[model samples]
Target: MSIRPTIETRKAVPTMEGAGVHLHRAFGFQDPSELDPFLLFDDFRNEVPEHYMRGFPWHPHRGIETITYVLNGTVEHGDSLGNTGTLGAGDVQWMTAGSGILHQEMPKGNAKGQMHGFQLWGNLPSAQKMTAPRYQDVQAKDIPEVIDDDGTVVRVIVGEFWGKTGPVDGIAADPQYLDISIPPGVKKTFRIDTYRRAFAYVFAGQGAFVDASAPSGVLLEKEVMGQEVNIRDMSGDRTLVRFGTGDEVTVQAGEEGVRFLLISGAPIEEPVAWHGPIVMNTQAELQQAMRDLRNGTFIKPAH
Candidate 1:
């Protein structure tokens, strides 16, 4: 408990990627071991169509995985491996680029042409970098949702929770992705494996994440339908909150509630050589990957 000394403030920085798509990167390209297995997180939420409509055109990915979760729009995607589909609101798509693949994602906004989603890149180890490529698409209804009596809602995306397993599996990173929402004034503590490195991103609402006695991030109380309650500041839309060592995580919702993505996975802890969308363990290996792509041998024989 002492090791988990409460909150560690996350610095927010803006970075661009994928054909002029603007986003605020929570953490990436700085330290490789701090949050291993997971390399980058981009909050590509935009109300203006001009900022996001261009979408992610044809891009090559190797030695990594892309997890796309859409909240309020549709994303039509097609890959070099002969897979094509559209993911609407509440849909999750996990693309494992084991070897190399060319893919494109074009976003079609909601009724108001407003689109919002998050893409998380997971780096693969050197051994599995050239495995067969595949995808796991989970529809909104298929994702199991657990709701507590106290009004806490959790959507299990890629891990087992309350005797239910998520649709995506056999992943190289073995990550746990959960979308959690807690009502105002409810104190909840959930235990996560200490071995896994975890972080949370506040997307919608805010709340205080408490660590035992010390107050790490306190939620400013606000009124919710005449109830005197502290509300979490949702001002930081793409803010990344990295936690210290702790087996259990406790969160208290403010008056208007708190919504965030809780993710954890075993750290790769290996050296990372990242360039654009490709992530590998060695720089030479990355060069070889690019060469292989040009040689038309990136996609190997199917198992």
Candidate 2:
């Protein structure tokens, strides 16, 4: 089996969004073709109420789908389409801003004043860019979880894995999103479609993703005299790993085990004209969308 090699590894950068909420941006607002079909990923994890309570005020989105997975705390959301809901810990909300829509998300921390969650923006293909807006509110209990014999747990968020399919469907990208946790010091390999673009985001503990022979990026946490004694340590909190072509990926957990999100999707490979939350095909279309927003005609009847 061909093991996917790590092409790039970088740490998430701190950024402010959603009415002054402090968060980390893993990737976004750059070359859309790099990740293709997928546009942005933001990790909104904070322990301070003032940092996140302001939350994402009313905003507009079009020509994209937003997937939000909450690890802790609650996110109260409302949209212009008269949809309102609360997403608690472990809940997920996938919103398709087809055509156009205005929405707002307010975050409330748990008793300990801790909030954690992630939002991923996936681009819609040119064909479905003007489709009807929809929402898939998946409860934590509804998401399927598989526990392997080696104590590896995988939470399938989208697509199929281990004979189980995710609850959210009818997506344009046909992506596979998996939340995985490996046992400490245990090595595990996951098979992915060779044609899909894949990436991993590490949120807890540490781990290394590498191939058997080449050793692209492995874990090396130990340090000697402030110098890293192990250059193999490739993963830690808020780390993003982009993989090269291969059919499978191998990861080794560190002492505290490793928890991360593995995601892959077919590349859209289309010309992208992105302006803030609106992603279209050309500059004129983007300008038209902005003009519609100002004219109160951005959102059209569901088609």
lDDT of each: 0.80, 0.90
Question: Per-prediction TM-score, please?
Answer: 0.90, 0.94
**Candidate 1 global lDDT:** 0.80
Superposed by TM-score, candidate 2 places the C-alpha of residue 210 at a distance from the truth, in angstroms, of: 1.8
Question: Model 1 reaches what TM-score against the true structure?
Answer: 0.90
lDDT of 1 by residue, 1-303 (tens): 333334554645777777777767887777878788888888878788888888899988988999999998899999887899999999999999988888999887899888988889898988988878899999999999999889889999998876778888988778899999888667678767788888888887666665433433765655544544333422234557777777877776655677889898888778888887788888998888888778987667787
Candidate 1 deviant stretches above 4 angstroms: 1-4, 212-236
- How many clashing residue pairs, candidate 2? 5
Per-residue alpha-carbon lDDT of model 2 for 1-303, expressed as tens digits? 799888888899999997999999999998898888789999999999999999999999999999999999999999999999999999999999999999999999999999999999999988988888999999999999999999999999899999989999999999999999998777789999999999999999887785533344554456422333244644899999988899999987877889999999999888889998999988888999999999999989764
Model 1: residue 176 alpha-carbon error in angstroms? 0.9
Worst-scoring 10-residue span by lDDT in model 2: 222-231
* Residue pairs in candidate 1 whose N, alpha carbon or C atoms collide under 3 angstroms: 206-232, 220-231, 221-229, 221-230, 221-231, 222-229, 222-230, 222-231, 230-254, 230-255
